[model samples]
Target: MSHKIIRSLLEGRLKAWAAARSPALRIAYQNVVFSPAASETYLRAFLLPAGTNSNDLAGAHRLYTGLFQITIVAPAGGGTGAAESLADELAALFPLYDRLTKTGFSVQVMTPVEPGPEQQGDTAFALPVSFQYRADTT
Candidate 1:
């Protein structure tokens, strides 16, 4: 329940931001089929739940933690400049200690957004930017 709300809150923010970009970046959301045209750059979003644990003896309090990842996929052979720039923008979007709340659920960014090493493939280069998030509830 809370996990779903957390996902919605985070993904909604990403979706809104993408829609407002000048060229309107496309995002391949979870379980959605997205086929970008050749040479088109896009993003893929994933929510990886770390786990949930009871925080109190009576299980009245709980803690949820997870990693939210966004992968930037750009055409192959293009230097990493474009991908890196987008990564920077995304990192800034979810700053450390930021909080998103909805339906009585609140999730906080637990770490600075970190960009992983680039993964090169025949058709595209994927640079993943990820951050940790935590939520608490009673």
Candidate 2:
């Protein structure tokens, strides 16, 4: 499948996660909401093609590298650690090594490149997460 399809799936998963925590966290960003207007909560999932090389079609199938960036944003109210709480809920949605697969492509692994940020600033919390997945575009 194309990267666009994969991205849509990722967005769906993110929205589903937020919906599950609507009552407690009140996640406002069902999609990737990035705005200065500011209500309270926001989240965005961005996917980019990191790099692609021949994984060898000689075997049976062809594999490609698909990297994605997931950024979760939340309000930073007071010094009361509101952002951290949001981060925790967000983390629960995408646990380590979560496997996401679809037709014509499959994510063999989802690995975090770096530690997710707990807080971005005094106004909002940002969790920047990266993952590399292997896609079989056969």
Best by lDDT: 1
Per-residue alpha-carbon lDDT of model 2 for 17-126, expressed as tens digits? 76776453333333545454364665556677655555565765555667665665666654435545655555565666776666645464466544365555866767
TM-score of 1: 0.97
Residue 117 of model 1 has an lDDT of 88
Instruction: Name the 10 consecutive residues with the lowest summed lDDT in model 1.
Output: 1-10
Instruction: Give candidates' CA RMSD values in order.
Output: 0.8, 4.0
The TM-score leader among the candidates is 1
Residue 137 in candidate 2 has what lDDT? 60
Can you write out model 1's per-residue Cα lDDT over 31-77, one digit (the tens) per residue? Answer: 98888888999999999998899978999988999999999999999
Clashing pairs in 1: none
The parts of candidate 1 lying over 4 Å away from their true place are none
The local lDDT score (0 to 100) that residue 86 gets in candidate 1 is: 94
Q: Estimate each model's TM-score.
A: 0.97, 0.66
